[model samples]
Target: MAESKTNAMRLLDKSQIPYETLNYDHEDGQIHGTAVAEKIGRPQESVFKTLVAHQSGQISQICVFVIPVAEELDLKKAAKAAGAKKIEMLPVKDLLKWTGYIRGGCSPVGMKKLYPTFIDASAEGLKIIAVSAGRIGTQMELNPQQLAEQVKAVFFPLTKEA
Candidate 1:
């Protein structure tokens, strides 16, 4: 059964954005994007992982990226997309403070603050993609464009060439 509404889900509701919840099994420790995709029974490319990153010397400017679980974030490309000199993933310890989300369960929607967010351009043609529902054992599915709009995100080539 689907669990109760998460903060992310609640916000989606408030925005009147249509989405579907997907429940999956999760282990106690960190779960990789591929494992998440498998648990949710979706193609690896259709499942995205939310990453928190920031440009050097600009810790206050947090950037969010929603990219394929199977792909690696191309720091150089992502930095360019965000108009930064360089970009690096934020430390895991600081994730909650910056984004109000944890490592494995982070979602682009309903963050502590709306920072600059980007969805991998590859998500453009895909009909739907799955992301964390702001908690473990859960995911949400919807059109990538809709997700981007809800979070005021840009579509950019932020992932390494696959």
Candidate 2:
């Protein structure tokens, strides 16, 4: 293919943001976030997944939470970030309908609409991170701060306490 382009990548390019795309072999089965990191040969801490959350089960108030692959999103913190009293993971079945991307390929960069986005505060220290490239079998690596700036995301505690 002559350079796989995605809306996320296009937006990054338009803004002159630098990023590197990594392609992997995606299998049909349970979507494992950690596996994507392994497949891309990156540490789990530097790879995040774009997960969509709903406020009180309302899609109209849907928000995106980008967190490390190995952590579970703290719903309470997510609700706080989205300015909602409650939040829950958007059902896997509704991933495409709401985010315009499938379970394994949702990037925080380019959604159908720019919903409120949040990144785990832990990510601030990392110089760079890998996130879904808005397509299966692909990922993009870039600075977390750049991603945050592009998405206008809040950095906060987003993972459940162990």
RMSD of each: 1.3, 1.3
Tens-place lDDT per residue, model 2, 39-60, is 8899999999888988995767
lDDT of each: 0.91, 0.91
> Compared with the true structure, what per-residue lDDT tens digits does model 1 show for residues 52-110?
99998778889999999999999999999899999989999999999888888899999
**Deviation in angstroms for 60 in model 2?**
0.9
User: Against the true structure, whose TM-score is highest?
Assistant: 1
Clashing pairs in 2: none
Clashing pairs in 1: none
Q: Which ten residues in a row have the lowest lDDT in candidate 2?
A: 24-33
